[model samples]
Target: MDLLKFITAGSVDDGKSTLIGRLLYDTDSILDDQLEAIQRANRKNDDGTLDLAILTDGLKAEREQGITIDVAYKYFHTEKRKFIIADTPGHIQYTRNMVTGASNADLAIILIDARKGVVEQTRRHSFLVSLLAIPNILVCINKMDMVDYDKAVFDKIQADYERLTKNMNSTQVDYIPVSALKGDNIAMRSPNTPWYDGKPLLEFLETVEVNQQPEVQQARFPVQWVIRPQTAELPDYRGYAGRVVGGSFAVGDRIVALPSGVASTITRIELASESLTTAESGASVIIHLADDIDISRGDMLVKAGEQPVLSQSFESDICWMDTRPLDVNQTYLLQQHGKTTKVKIQDIVYRIDIETLERTASDGFGLNDIGRIQFKCADPLAFDRYAFNKANGGAILIDTRNNLTVAALMISEPVDH
Candidate 1:
């Protein structure tokens, strides 16, 4: 089964967690013991249903507050697909946590209460998921049970959402009216809304197409480590080890290693003990080159004619996670493609209004703030624009004193020289 990584986001009480729990429950992905434990807790929703939200509110603090604070990840597999679901907090204060969970997701399940229509959080999360460039969005209008599964409510909310997101970056948007708590239109279509017609959540998830696979795009092999089994027999063997992030690499293909820009041909590729002729993206393997040049971590291997942007300065879109606002004078460590280098902020272009997607002049960013900023690295780094290749274009900022990751960066176009 193919794997799909998605996230759930909405306002608190919008049923994000409940939607996840229902998807798991209806798919029979939950263990009997797990279900029994939830039942044993004796917590019941106001509608007299077993509190399925407890299935994902694993943290006691979360259960106590009836709110999710940290990103809760759940894994399950059905016959059609394997899934990684990130249930993120919906509170504005926990916005950083939501960004962290959404960073690597292929799709987002942005929830809305049928009774509440589109609230402020609906706008906030919509802007965020769009900023993150999450390819697909399943905007699940949840809590239809509370609204009596009214088609008018669903249609109005869906219309409002479409108008609001008309300018957002989300490429594909799908809507499903569901009652997550009551399992209505989740696994099977609910008959309560005779005027509505759409596939259940599970059915859509099982078949949604996401073309974010790296192997099928341009090839990128960022060097992570150098492997030299210094044993007696393998003294001459040297292999570059890393995960293939894009395209495919095959034996005898002409390749170039960047920063140094050395040209070489692949001698062999090995995944574990098995030797292979080609390695696709997402594969972790040791690549032996025909030429033993000075290859090291941070170097990128690409097809001879294919090269990523190599520069010391570039434009970056950042979602700051630090509580202490950004300091213009501070130097940070830019970690990208498994390599770290000293970096400093060159300029802050503008601050984006997460709620309205507005661009305005800004001094700096604070916690959960999003901005377009320029950065200068100590060394030239090879990268593609995040829109072109997500694997090579992503980076993080870390404080040198404490090594705390303070920002997530998505490299956009390079700054004009």
Candidate 2:
């Protein structure tokens, strides 16, 4: 079965954690021992009620504060498909955690409290999802029980949310009414919501076409490691092992190595126990070139004509992950694919306001700030626009002094009309 990776985002106390816990419980995905543990915790904290939120509050700090501070991942599978949930924190202080979780998500679930309707955090998360270019979005209006399960209330919230989404550039958005605390309209549809005819949350998740996004337009394989046997039995064995970031490559396809500008044909593709003729995106394979021409870990292989732009300077939108403010003159190490190079921030173009999506010219960025800026690298880096290919277009900045990942970057060029 195919796997679906999704991230959950919402305001604090919006029932994001409870919704996930209920989904696991209703779908029989939780083990008996795990359920017993949760029951024990619930009984201990009981004031005549079961704290279903305890199911996902795994961290001690989270359990004590009743708020998620970091991304909590959970795995479960139904008959139709498997799921990996990235339960991200909803607080403003933890916005960096949300960005990290949503970076690899194929879908985003933005929940809203029915009683509170659309709040500031709802807009903030929706904007962040749009900024990240998450392909699919599901707007779940939670806590319908608090509103007496009224269809009118659900309709009003839906309308308001639709209006709010008008400013977003999302391709697909869905709305569903649910009560996570009571397990209503989660895995199974609720009879109480007779007026609501949409499928349950789990049903939608199982059937949604999460992989319908466009395929890579260009093939890119960055060499992560090189395998060479020294023994006589396999003395001449040589292969470049890496993951295919974009497009597909076949055994006989002609390819070129970047930076060196050398051409070679793919002789074979090997996996753990078998050899394949072709490799597609997300596949890890060992590629044997027809002629070995000094390829290393940082080198990239691409089709001769479909090569990415090579440059030492480029502009990108960055999400600062560190607590210290970014210094424009400071130098950092940039890691792309398996390649690393020293780079200096040349200029601070503008900082984006998360709430309003407006650009403000600034000298530096603070923690969790998103902005577009230019960088000057020590050597030419091969990349594509983030909108075209996520893997090739994305990079991470690391502080050389502390070896800390400080920011996530998306490469882009100024549009020419």
Candidate 3:
């Protein structure tokens, strides 16, 4: 079965985790012991109804505070497909956690409380979904039960959201009115909303293709390890081991080693010790180059005609994730597509006002602040624009001093010289 990686995000108490719990519950994907544990937590619920949120709010602090403190991942599958669900936090302070969950997601389900409509967090998340370039967006207008399952309410909120996301870069935007608590429009249709005719969320998830318009990125692989198992019988076993970050690699394909400008053909491809003619994106495989070029960890292999941008400095949009203010004088480490190098923040171009979609002068990015910044890497970075491919363009900034991640970097369009 194919797999889908998705994340759920929204404001605190907007039922993001509960929606996931309801989906898992109605799908019968929960185990007996897990249900028993939830049943025990249900006894503490204010109302007689069970607290389905406990299923995903697994952290003790989350359960105690009734909030999601970190990104909790859950896995389940139906006969149709498998899924990896990332339940992200909703609070503004936890924006870094949300970004981490969204970096590699194929789709996102942004929950909107029916009574509250679109709030600040909703806009921030929608913008991030665009920045992260998540293709499919399912805006779940949740808590319909509290809103009396009113179609008018859903319609109005949908209109407001459309206006808010008019400038976003998301490819597809869809909506559903759901009552995560009552299980309406979750796994099964609800007659309460006779005017609405969309399929249930789970049904949509099962049927819809998350990568609706797949970006055909050029084959790019960053060597993670050099495998040279010197078995006396078959000695020359120098293979470059890494996961395919973009496109596909196949035997006999003309490939180029980046930063060094060495060219060669793929001599062999191995997956789990089995030889293969081709390895697609996200595949973990060992590749052997014909020429035995000077390739090593952090060096990328790509199609000769479709090489990624190689530059020592590039501009990008950055979400400041550190607790302290960004320090321009401090050098940070930039890691992208398995390659790491020391980088310096050269300039802060501007900060974005997500609410107004305005760019204003800014010295440095503060926590949760999105800004355009220039970075000079110690070595050449092979990257694509985030809009072209997320895995190709997404990177993180690490503080060399403490080795803590301080920012999420999404490379913007490269300027032509």
Candidate 4:
């Protein structure tokens, strides 16, 4: 079974957790001990109801506050596929946490309360998901039970959301109506809303095609470590080890080490208990070179014909994470993959208005603000556009003094020459 990773996002009290808990419970994914524990807790509660939300609200503070403060991950499986769900917080204050959770997700399931109908938080998260370039989006209009499962209500919400998404860059969008509490149209077809004849949420998830092509326009492999075994068993063994950020590498392929620009041919590819001829994106393997080259941690290996832009200056879209305002001329450490370097903000072009989708001319950015900015690194860095390659295009800025992550960046454009 293939593994599928997805994220859940919506406004507070939209039953995001309940939907997930229902999906797991109804599918028989929960263990017997877990069900028994939940039953005991349900009996002790004053409401005397199951409170299925308790299955995911495992934290003491979460139960007391009745809101998810952090990203909660849940794992379950069906006969057809394996699932990894990231239950991200919906409150505005936890926007940074949401970004962290959705960074690696293949799809995003955005929920909206049928009665509420496209609230501010919904727009905020939708914009973020688009900015992150998440390929697939499933907009689930939840809590249909409260609205009498009205078809008109679902259509209105869908129309409003469609108008909003028209300006965004998301490639795929799907709409579904569900009542998470009663398990209507979640794991099974709902008789309550016979007007809707689409596949259930579980079926949609199992059948969604998530195969993505490797970003091969620019080959990149940031060296994590230099593997060396100097014992008598196999002396003079030197290998460059790292995960492929973009493209593939095969034995005997010509490669160029960046910053030094030394040429070499791939002599071997090594993995645990196996030797492979080729390696693709997301695979960690040690590569042996035909020539003795000076390469170390923080250096990158790329195909000689497809070299990435190496620049000291670049522009990026940044999601500010720190409470303190961003300042021009201030220095921070930019970390990408295994490479880290000191960088300074050259300027802030503009801040994006999530609701209006407009760029407001702003000199500074506050927490949770998304803006376009220019950066100057201490040295030239290899990179590709975020749309082309997520691993090579993403970066994090850290405050030097406090060592706190202040910004999450996506490379928008690279400076030529």
Q: Write the per-residue lDDT of candidate 2 for residues 1-417, one digit (tens) a residue.
A: 999999999989899878988888777888989878877775532236566677766653654676635678889999999999998877766777888889888899999999999887787777778767889889899989989999999999889888877777755888889998887889888998999899899999999987666888699999999999878898999999999999999999999998788999999999995999899989999999999799989889999899998888999988898888887778999999999999998888898776666778898899878879889888778888887888888999999889988898988863221
For each candidate, the alpha-carbon lDDT, in order, equals 0.86, 0.86, 0.86, 0.86
| Model 4 TM-score, all chains together | 0.93
Q: Write the per-residue lDDT of candidate 4 for residues 115-164, one digit (tens) a residue.
A: 99998788888888988888888999999989999999999999999998
- Judged by lDDT against the true structure, how good is candidate 3? 0.86
Error of 3 at 391 (Å): 1.9
Q: Count the backbone clashes (under 3 Å) in each candidate.
A: 0, 0, 0, 0
Model 1, 291-358: lDDT tens per residue? 88998888889999988889999998888987788998999999997789999888999988766677
- Looking at candidate 4, the ten consecutive residues that score lowest on lDDT are 42-51
Q: Is candidate 1 or candidate 3 better by lDDT?
A: 3
lDDT of 3 by residue, 288-342 (tens): 9888668878888999899989988889998989888899999889988668999
| Model 2 bad stretches (over 4 Å) | 42-49, 60-70, 150-152, 414-417
Q: On a 0 to 100 scale, what is the lDDT of residue 8 in model 4?
A: 95
> Which regions in candidate 1 have their CA more than 4 angstroms from the true location?
60-70, 212-216
